[model samples]
Target: MFGDMMNMMGKLKETQKKVEETKKRLDSVLVDETSSDNKLKVTLTANRTIKSVEIDDELLEDKEQLKDYLILTLNKAIEKATKINEAELAATAKEGMPNIPGMDMFK
Candidate 1:
């Protein structure tokens, strides 16, 4: 019984280490999304924070249109970023807990 307890404690420590490594890797990941026309772009961190946005000079000619395009582009970029983050998180969670049921729910 004592050996079993020690083995479980070791496994828990290993899992904790893996979780920390995954967090660090996720923090370092970045996702970039752009509009179809390339007039607008957005960079997002793995945690889904907007890092930056860019707009082409040609779009500046029409202020109203530029504004609309920017909004649309930003929304699309955010959506893309969200999907990427979700996929990555799912993958990481699966890798960390392959045999555990409902493991991703904690993520």
Candidate 2:
């Protein structure tokens, strides 16, 4: 029993390291979103950090329209980044989990 406990602890440590590495990798994963007419675009990392925003000259004419476009496009980009971040982290965690009795049910 003691040996099994030690092994499980080691596995958990390894999993933690892998999770941190996965997070760093996610920083480079980019997600892009654009307004319907393509007047506005946004890019974000899987970490949900905004990378860039591009706006068309026409959008500059109306501040309200630009605000709306930025909100819509940025929200979409954030949603995509969140999905990617969650999925990647989940997969990494699942992959590293130590197999134990009845844990298959969670998988």
Candidate 3:
């Protein structure tokens, strides 16, 4: 029983190490998302910080349309960045445990 407990502790430590490494790797990643019409675009880091925003001259011709497009594109970029970050976190969680018992308690 003592040996088993020690082994479990060792495994948990290793998993924690891996999780930290994965987070560091994810921090260095950046995702770029562009609008479908290509009139607006945004770049975001995995941590969801906006790196840059770009708007085409054609889209700026109409003020109302330009505003709408900018909002739409920004939303899309944020959503994409959120999904990517979730995926990375989920992957790390999975690596820690395939299915954690009573995991709902944490939530």
* Top model number, TM-score: 2
TM-score of each: 0.61, 0.94, 0.66
lDDT tens digits, residue span 1-107, model 2: 89998998899899899999999999999999989999898999999999998999999999999999998899889999999999999998898888777787646
Model 2 lowest lDDT segment of ten: 98-107
The CA lDDT at 81 in model 2 is 93
- Candidate 1's C-alpha runs over 4 A off are 1-13, 61-63, 98-107
* Model 2 pairs whose backbones collide: none
* Reference-based TM-score, model 3: 0.66
1 versus 2: better TM-score goes to: 2
Any runs in candidate 3 off by more than 4 Å, and if so which?
A: 58-66, 98-107
Against the true structure, what is every candidate's RMSD? 4.1, 1.1, 3.9
Tens digits of per-residue lDDT, candidate 3, 1-107, equal 68776776777677788778877776678878888888888887777788888899998789999888878887877787778888877777666652335664433
For residue 83, what is the lDDT in candidate 1? 77
lDDT of 3 at 11: 72
lDDT (Cα atoms) of all candidates against the true structure = 0.73, 0.91, 0.77
Point to the candidate with the largest lDDT. Answer: 2
> Which of candidates 2 and 3 is the stronger one according to TM-score?
2
User: Candidate 3 lDDT (Cα, whole model)?
Assistant: 0.77
